[model samples]
Target: MFPGTEAQEETLMMELSRLVQEQVQGSSWWELRGKDCAILGLAFVALAPGFLLLRSSSLLLFSLGLLLLGVSHAAITVKGAHLSSHSSLTRSPLLNRIWAVFFIEVCGAFSADAGVQAHIKMHHAHTNVLGLGDSSTWKVPGLSRSLYLFIAPLAVPVITPLVALAQLKHQPLLSSLRTLLMVSLGLWSHFWILVHVSEFGSTLSALGCMFVTRNFFSLPYIHVNIFQHIGLSMFSPEQRPKRIYQMSHGVLNLPRNLLLDWTFGHSLISCHIEHHLFPKLSDNMCLKVKPIVSRFLALKSLPYQQDSYLSRLRLFFDQYQELMVLAPPITELVGIQ
Candidate 1:
C-alpha cells in the first residue's frame, strides 16, 4: 500500500522475512540468555551501591549514589520491562510473562498488562496512527512550550505509577488484582530495604531517597520515548500501509551513544528499524541483524530513518510549536493501486 507496486512490496517483504529467518537460524539461545543475565546483574549492581550509601552523612555522596540508583531504574524500565513486555527477552512464554510481572509491574512501577496492551497491541500494531499509536509525551493542552518541554518530563516518574493504577480498572479482574498486589509488595519491599538495610533512620529520608533515585533520569527517558515515533508521519487505520512501509516511515532511530545504548539497549537507540521489522527479536539480535536490514532497505530504495540525538533534541526545541504544542496532523500518503 506504499508508493511501490504490489510486486515491489512483495519482494521487500520476502527479503525482510528471509533476513529475519537467517538471523534466527544463526542465533544461539545460550548467548541470549547470557546477555539477559548480564544486564539484569548490572541493574542490581547499579542499585546496591545506592542502597549502601543512602544514609551517608555527606550530601554529595548521597546525591551521586542516588544518581546511580536512578540510572539503574531507568535501565531496568527501558531494557528489561520493555523487552519483557514484547515477550522478546527469552524464548519461553512462561518466563517472559513472569519477567514482565517482575520487572515491569513490580520494579518498573507500571502495569504489565497495560503496557502490553498499549505498547505491543496498539503502539507496535499501529505505529504513528493518529489517536492510536502516536504515544506523544507532550499532550498537555494549554501548557506553554517552555514549561511543557522542561517541567512536564520531570513528572514522568510520578505519573507512571498513577497511570498504572488507573489502567488496572480496564484489565480483567484477576490481572488487575495481580498487578495491584505486585505494585504494593514492590513499593513496600523498597521502603523496607531503605529503612532497615540502608539504615536511612527515618521514613521521610527513605522515601526521599526512593523518589530522587527513581526520577533522576525521567527527563531523558521521556525524551527518548517521544523522539522516536513522534515528529514523523502519522496514519489512519485505513490509510496505514504494510508493516515494513509503516515502520520505515514512522520510526526514527537516534544515533547510538554508549551510555544510552547500554541503559536503553541497542534496539531503542540504534537498530530501531530492525526492531520495528522484527518486534519479537531480542535487542542483541536486532543489533546483529542491523547491517542486513539496512543493506536491504538501501537496495530497495526504502527509507531508513536515522537522526542524531542532539539534532532530534534541537528539532523538538525549535519546532515545539508545530510538533508538540499543536497536535501533529495525520500524514496522508497515496496508496498503490
Candidate 2:
C-alpha cells in the first residue's frame, strides 16, 4: 500500500509512459537488431588486426595494437554485448547468449556468469548501498580530487573482478565454479597470446608490458559502468515505486559524447533511464524509446537526471572527498529550517 494516495499519481505516470511508448510503436530510436550486428561486426574487424599484431610486430606496434584491441573490446562488451545479453538489446534468446559469451569471455576477458551476477543481481538490486551495492571501490575517502582521477585507471582490471567475485560468495557452488572457469579462460587467452608473441623476442618482458597495458587501458570501460549509477540515489526497497523511477532517479545519464556513445552504446549513457524503466530494451531500441520516456517522466512531473560529460567528470572530481567514505546524511539545523 503506497501512502498519501500517490497511487493515483503512480497510475498516471504509468499511463503516460505507455502512451508515449505507443506513439513510438514500441520501437526505440533506431533499428535495434541492426545495431547489434553493426557493433559485433566492427568488433570482429578490430580483433583481426589485434591477432596479427600479437604475432608479428615490434613491441611498439604490438602495444598499440593491444591498446586498440582493449578499446574495441570495451566498446563491444559494454555496448554491443551487455544490452543483448540482458535481452535489452534484442528479442532472440539464443543469439543474445551467444553474443554474451563472445563479448564476456573473449572480449571482456571475464566471466559472463560473474558479470551477470554483479551487474543484474547486486548492482540492480541494491545500488549505491554503501558497502553493499557499492560499485565504486576505486574511490577512497579524504583523497584529493586529483588523486582519485589519477589512480582510477590503474585499479580497473586488478580491483573490479575481485570486488565482483566477492559479491558472488553466496552463489551456489556450481554457478560459482562455472564463473571461475570462464574467468580462467579469459585470463589464459591473454597470457597465451602474449607468450606466443614473446617467442619472437624477450617473452618475459613482453608479458609484463602486455599485462600492464592491457589493464591500464581498461579504465574507461570501468569508469563508465560505475559513474553511470553509483553516485545516484539509493532507495530502500520499501519506498521503491515503479522501475522507471528506480532507473531515472537512481541512475544518472552522462552527456552524449559521440566517440564514447558510438563505442559503448546507450548503456554507457542513454538507455539507462529506459533501462531502469524497461530493462529489456536493447541499446538500439533504447534511443528510439528515449523521447517516449522523457515525455512520460515530464508529464508526471518527475526529474530525469542528465548531465554533460564534462559536468559529470567535474562532479566525480569534486565529490572525490566523500566518495567511498561511509557517512551519514545531513539534516538542516533548527534555525536553518
Candidate that would win on TM-score? 1
Estimate the TM-score for candidate 2. 0.78
TM-score of each: 0.93, 0.78
- lDDT by residue (tens digit), candidate 2, 1-337: 2222356656765786677557447444456567656776786687667756766558887777776676666677667657756865446778778777766755565567767766677776665554444574455666665655666567566665565477457668876676666666766776676667434356676556555645644556656665776567654433444444555556777766676776777756766776656566566666777777787778766678887766667767766545446542322112111
Error of 2 at 162 (Å): 4.4
Question: Model 1, residue 100: what's the lDDT?
Answer: 90
Q: Give the lowest summed-lDDT range of ten residues in model 1.
A: 30-39
lDDT of 1 by residue, 90-114 (tens): 7789999999999987897889988
- Residue-pair clashes per prediction, in order, are 0, 7
lDDT of each: 0.80, 0.62
